[model samples]
Target: MTDQTAPTDPAEVTAHLDARLDDDARAWFAESRDRIGDDPAAVRVLFPAVSRRVGRGPLAPGGDGDDPFVWHRDDAGRALLLAAVDPGARPGELRDCYTHGDARERRGVLRSLEVVEVDDEVTAELVDDALRTNDVRLVAAALGPAGVAVLDDDGFAQAVLKAVFVDLDLERIAGIPDRVTPELSRMMADFVHERVAAGRAVPASVWTVIDRHPPADRLAAIEAERDHEDPHRAAAAAAALDARP
Candidate 1:
């Protein structure tokens, strides 16, 4: 493994990779990196190592003629390998090293791969993976009003609500309406009820949606449904209902 911290710049890294691999190796590098995610830095580091092991040829003699050095089964292996050696390196950089490294060297490099920061949203998105797999702390770090709306629409409302409860406040919730769909609005109401029931703080801005779309009785019914699962939520629903008068 080349010293990742060898004080090399982007240009130096690119030159090193180009000299070590041929046209076939370069093509595999591009394809593999694209399959993982877009991050040019990752490609720069992966190709040279691959070329070293596979001699710039396809993996099998007469198989699919695919670059056998590249580990297609491990989606994020390239990124993982790079991160193992250089803990402080960015996800993009690590991804580059694996995708551009030599074919023969690719397999051994992949075995060293690890999922160091599962909670990094940028890494998650770049790796073409789901953020829901992240911890609450990671989810909280990744979320904002816009991200929340995206997550909600993608059927990740539960995750979004969890993030909101942990990180968002009234001001943040106030901005949520702009991103809320009718479906998401209802989901948000349910989430708020859950929080209130748990004696967790409720962001007052959520009431804007509750007050605007659904009639009071309808809102009450939604709250009642939530209350069924949690008694404290029932009391909170009752209070919201009484306040409506």
Candidate 2:
């Protein structure tokens, strides 16, 4: 809502929603484009309460749920807001929208992250906030191209770990394979070891960063798992070993 100077691209929203949603659903997106002016505050004011509790599961558009359908509404609202408040649409406003809005609203803000440009610090803060939550949608949104680019290395590591901790899709995150750091690699190695101890399946994708020159002991542990009964664990172990020299 803060004085928006940047132009919001409705196309950005359409690009994400058009192909995925039905034409009936897509029409509203195009319709919502003109619903706002230079000030996007009015719509946010009437959005679902930040404190409202929406139960789990999918929702119909404008329906009584908090999933994708509800998310669509929130996305449309944000797109409209962005359209009206471009030129200076800051991340602080985004953070505020995500914080003050309900589950779907938070998702919408995260969805809008790519289109709305702000300072790196603000991006880091918003991405951190999203990762801190366990909501799969919000986390997915935070890992978008812009979001990942804005994150500091430490913040990036935390986001990656948090994603794994929640068992979300790493495929949704941008700049993964190329962004790995030794610190992140070490953290992933420890996570792998912990999951093994707990008898939980370490997400196979964790190996993307985990295979980076593990210590001798860790390598030995991975080698030991190669013949374990759990084929997945064994495959993961083998993959880890193969990923290295």
Candidate 3:
């Protein structure tokens, strides 16, 4: 996946992946990249071979802070593979790649959306398909920056609600701050209400989204969170209330 450091720019990502590879793997990667460029159909074969060819370790190691995008070595390889495809054929290839490939391959296609050029409708369909699945990893991959860029307001809010339904960490869905809407706040509040009524614990991460788009007239649910037994939820509610206009 793309990050602030790499931003999914194919050239930058290639360089990042190249620097981490040993001499032999690096050579293989370069050859594969060019081979896919020459014969776009070859990507079907090379796409799944990335993890074996390049290590599966994080391309950039995480540290103590808000987690940056952690691209596995194979993820970068796959993105580069997509980038190597002829732009005219890339959309069809991407759709096939997502359809035929297993979960990880599908995730790679979703995460690599920004790096490869394609029709918005094509990416939208892929994102929609991923969001419909019960697979948590695939769902999370679909809500990432690439997916975020393509989803409209209602679709995005529903996706966030879907994350809650499947118990995904809201933090994993990047670009939430910029994408938040009152509809999202309402949906999150409804979720909070259901959980509270059922005596189920609310995910603390949901509060982050609520705080971001705190509905002007519906502060009660969020305000009530101020005294939540979980200190994290309590603090998030306190912040949301204190910041309320």
lDDT of each: 0.42, 0.60, 0.77
Tens digit per residue, CA lDDT, model 3, 155-192: 98889899889887775676766678878887787777
Top-lDDT candidate index: 3
Model 2: residue 133 alpha-carbon error in angstroms:
1.3
lDDT tens digits, residues 1-245, model 2? 11121113566444544444556544544444444344545445533431222222222333434222133434544544554554454444566776787767777666566565567777677778888888777786677677788888888888889888877655446767677787888888877766654445666677767665345666567678878898777776666556453
- Cα displacement (Å) at residue 10, model 2: 4.2
lDDT of 2: 0.60
Q: What's the residue-level lDDT of 232 in candidate 2?
A: 71
Q: Which segments of model 3 are wrong by more than 4 Å? A: 1-6, 62-69, 216-245
The residue-level lDDT of candidate 3 at 188 comes to: 84
For every model in order, what is the number of clashing pairs? 25, 8, 0
Give the Cα-based TM-score of candidate 2 against the true structure.
Answer: 0.69
Ranked by TM-score from best down, the candidates are 3, 2, 1
Residue 38 lDDT, candidate 2, scale 0-100: 41
